[model samples]
Target: MFEQGDWGSAADWAVAPVDHSRLKHPVQALTAMVLVARQENAAAAQKVFTAVCAYRMGIAEDFDRLGEQAADWLGVGAEMEVALVLGVSVGTARKLISVGVTLDTRLPLVKAAFVAGELDFSRVRTIVDAVDGVSEATVSAVEAAIVDAALQRPPRALANEIARLLIAANPDDAAESRKKREKHSRTVKITPDSHGMAALFATMTAAEGVVVSTRIDEMAATVCRRDPRTPATLRTDAFVALINCETHLACRCETADCPFAHLPAAEPATVHLHVHVDVETLLGFADNPANLEGHGPIDPDLARRFAQDATWQAIVEETRSRCPAKAHPAGFVPTATKLLPPPVPSGIGGAIADIKAAIDADPKVLDGEFPDGHGGLDEPPPGALSYRPRKEVKDKVYAKYSTCTFPNCYVPVRKCQFDHIEPFDHSDPERGGWTIESNGHPACPYHHQAKTDGIFRVVRMAGDAIVWVSRNGAVGITIPEELGGSHEPEARKPVKLTRPAPAEDPPDDAIYDPTWWEQHMQSGDRPPTLADMAQLTDRRLAVIYRELGTHYEEHLAILAARDRHMPPPY
Candidate 1:
């Protein structure tokens, strides 16, 4: 629709209109333009990095010839120069330069992909680091098989795939590699956490680690048999008590052969572990991993070991309505999910009866679970003066946005405070925004403070659409997940237009073409020459990228020659 417009001048462009063709017009074109831009930008970055590699290679090859005296007299060092300019440590600067050089010198297919911009630096680093010290023969074979796959995969996924490929290439080497990796343990590290606590982690053999973790879980359950602390806290304290030889101070489980049975111990406690294992894995006939609740899947062998001490309870997961429905209502205590053999959790009932009563009578909770209007806030009755939202309203509002409405801020909604998008009018409460889901959004304490201090302003649009304007004049939109702008329009908007001027392509010719090495590397036994582009198979041409790592006037010459002889569609 933009094609049929008189949109050359600003005035003409304003008068000329466009048909918002959902299938073909602006949206598709906009998406295509973004992808093209990313590809082009990546190619440009690759070209710069390629030159950086060449410079490093030159310095390395000539450093000895230049002599220490020459280096000092010239008032320069390539290493320090890169370090300062890139703001990286000297070691990092060296590696950055070396990666480019090594990639260009060895993996032609990888280099081609990088140059063409199909694979960005992160993906390139994955390939280079994986093949770093491998023999040239292995490197060549790995590169041939992995570059195309790498371009199609994310960095982490590509690394996993390469591990399988490398193992297949040399099983003996893989065994040795595993043996070397095993040497990395026999150490413990401590990292600080919130709440004035720290995590003390250990690295050990898998079998030993699983046994140790299970022991801690058992000891923790017994120690906290009647205590109200969370299972996680009890487990940590249990581990600490044992390691410090202070089990008597914390543990109170007493049973025959119990480690702390006779030392200020009481009733033995049962521990529950949720493990999912297939029959084949359970029988040692397969290597399929098992799923451990709370943790991710574990090794099949490890899963069986955990199952030995654990009494199995078959749990059929229940999928309920998207609405939490019963998780949090206007009540003080939430009812459990209505599953068969209901899984009632622990700890909540341990609260004092007085505290529960106080919570039940609180103004927020007294507002009742049901909303007065379609899940939105209701106006206060004529006699009522307070405008505070109900527990249900606040809970729904917080859960609606699981994170702070501030763009890129990850503060969880539970940790955030609800703020009125339009400041509540305390003087004339009803005239001001009502304290309801539509008027409220979760903002972390810091952001809430900022909003109060006028550093941020929020506007609630039609249907709870939040528009957050930042101190720096950035506007961010937060749409409720269920009410995203995904619905199709009822009718298309017809637009009148005249001829519009064409947008000029980038000053540099866009590139995603493959050169001779790229062609030769990917073609297997039969390779295509520069003149055989039209004869090039889709598989071959697919790997050939353009406007990437090695692009410049010199590449332009090669590209032009190939295009003139026989053109291949991009």
Candidate 2:
């Protein structure tokens, strides 16, 4: 060691800074490799997989380009893989194809326009029904955007891009738009007819603050006059709304004689349950005038006659009793107990077994039509609740936790579950129940367990971003660049509470239009629009002849050809 200078002349060596730029591509490639290796990151792989498979399938250049850009190449590859492995049926093929196409692009938004109600695609749809939407050109443009985004980023990023495209191009039907705009404004008031109408009148406060002193029969007549073919579902639903608005049954007496006597003054006043009715049988009553016991088919003109009766009001105002209501005993069903038949015959496993059997047989025969999973739906699965609450719940979980809540794990929502920051069971019912609102936090199960097992604790700071304090008392706030907005779980970014920045002069290129490259290559060459993406996919599949044997032979031949062409590495 003392003779180092004499032995090595100070060990002169030039340690040049390694050029990391050359390694960037390989790093990205390796990152992608790791991503595709996992089943959860299949969405990213799907884009590339679909594109490559489409090229193999002899798809058109235009569409192959689309597939490549959208990275639907991986998806198509998976489909072929499934078909080859599982011997997928024609119906299954159709379904998978539809889903693949929809998920590969922003097409669901277009198809959603023609359907009534919320933009939910869970209902059944005919193939013909699926095609109903805006013009093809618009949809193609949207898909193009999705494909562009897919090529640039990962699956979640692609979805965000698709969402942005949808917002920019509102593809909703004109009629649907008008209806949506008019929905809250179109108000109607009607009084439901029941024995003892006075009691119902007294409960008017319980109604939706919507009360009309007129009979439902009269209201139905008025609605009929507006639209000749009033559907029964609509009529019944409207009646339910009317009842929700104007009917309340209360008992002043706290004695055992009254059914509601056990409840204190602060207790819930009304217990609402679904009233079931058989439509066909009810309609049968409408067929015969003589079938109406003393009264004709609910004459609208007779509302005045009934409204003047004091006996009806007295009965309506009376207290609840053990005796159920006298209305349509045979036809009416308790609302809650009617629609879904009180869970399955047994537990979840039984229901699942039944579903499996249905799948083996005809699924239609089992669960009726599929309640959700419409032909070309693309929206993410809603979590926990069927309906999202009106106000934004700060601690509410996302449909999925898109990113790793653990400071280290950046796994996305597709592989995530809600994490209760404070263990849910910690809240005693004796004190208060744990609700999904404040107690729930979206996290991958692994990270959630880590948080729960006294390793870490998650807290939402002022900016709504999650901050974690480790058991060792190390404080680390996840920066946005390290992950994405999944940790925040808000629909939009919260307004910055910091003081506004001073206005700066706009750059000369601030409002610059698209360049020639953008106009021709970048923007124009985006994948098909959301509306046209599915149809185009179907059309491509229809023409691409599924020559399984030919494909297999071709694949083998290609492997052989590659063997002949390539030199073996030592």
Candidate 3:
């Protein structure tokens, strides 16, 4: 049997072999050295060994965090933004918050707390607080809900592994409560460094979106044991378990004896902001599927950069380049260019031309051939030279006014129309034919009508200023800064009209061209309109109203018959 003296000496040996020279600080050096000896010590020295081991683990955690801070300074913080959108469904918002919490706990501090036997709600909150951009109020509220939920059940008695894992995986009811409270939680911490600002700015600018975890926590489920059955087994615990499983290969640690021996200190994961934008809202901006340039999958950082990039700015500039802006729904027109322009088309010269040509060439094309009440025109006369169908004009209109052709109307392509520069009735086929691409320019319907009815006129002034002559003759000279000092003449395409052959009764083959219809249908493609929506809704509501009306009539008729059968009152 081992004697007391032998046990005491063994314990002393376990605690006393610490080397101060090997560590930067005396306490840490002492702690690590003792742990090294304790691992080699016998069973008689178990208590001493455990103490040394705990101290050593504590020191290692401190050094690990120090290393993390160093890495952050070096721009190695694996970063991502977590945007909290304003008007999401409760369920989706909770999922996003849960994802945020999961990402928060991925920090070095939280993982270290788990290894050091100090994991709890307080520790988790601390982990959240450490993130640069997260608001303290938000974390505080979320932490409270998480703690309340954790304290409700028996599993709460176990270590925080289960709770932390749930924070990452199953933040359901608790997440909702936290999100509600977060409405009042608007404060965000700012970091002055590279990764910190990059993450914060990217998220804030993509305010309708946020960044989130890109790290796939494959080991978050199986290895994270917080139950009483595996309380003493550190390797079985989630913190250590993740490291042991080669699931996250990049974050795997190689040390054998340390508590964090398997958990590798690695970068943070992140997701994009646009991915979380409301689906219908995103769809509302896409006029044509082909004009949907920034739609679909994108990285949060990349999406913001794209928004602020020169190319996107150029497209916006081009679309709204020459159109007059109408008053907003509140009956106010914006004078500022700060806010992102709405996706509406603006260039109106082409749309005016197209409408006039429809009226002039085939007065019937307005309500007859095109028949969607396209142009306000009367019937075609005998031997009248009718215009090309509206669909033909629409195709060219889309190509010329890729977006809004107006100087400042960047509405989408589908929202715009082709207008004539000179009224089609007045347009000289000899000077520049109606079909000449340059004769018509694209414009939004509002501006199209405004310009066509002579509410506005486009003409050159003394300089490069394009003067807008109002209906009341008050001229507003729009001196475009971009076009300063240039007065270029309008370029017109020379027209060539062929004489028609002596008409016999025109054959159906002479007019109904299959290629023309095919091309027209392909070109006038706009997203579902208010009219389409109204039609569907009307059909649905008609059935409902008809049933209700019939029910009321039957009941009234029965009552009237009963009254007729009853004796008359004195």
By lDDT, who's the top model here?
1
- The per-prediction CA RMSD against the true structure, in angstroms, equals 32.3, 36.8, 31.0
Q: Rate the local accuracy (lDDT) of all candidates.
A: 0.52, 0.35, 0.35
lDDT tens digits, residues 23-84, model 1? 37666778766566557646555644754754554455335555553443221234433443
Candidate 2 lDDT tens digits, 356-413: 3433454223121111212112322233232232223322234212355444444543
Query: For candidate 1, what is the lDDT?
Result: 0.52
Positional deviation of residue 83's Cα in model 2 after best superposition, in angstroms? 17
Task: Show the lowest summed lDDT stretch of 10 residues, model 2.
Answer: 312-321
- In model 1, how large is the Cα lDDT of residue 173? 68
For every model shown, the clashing-pair count is 14, 41, 38
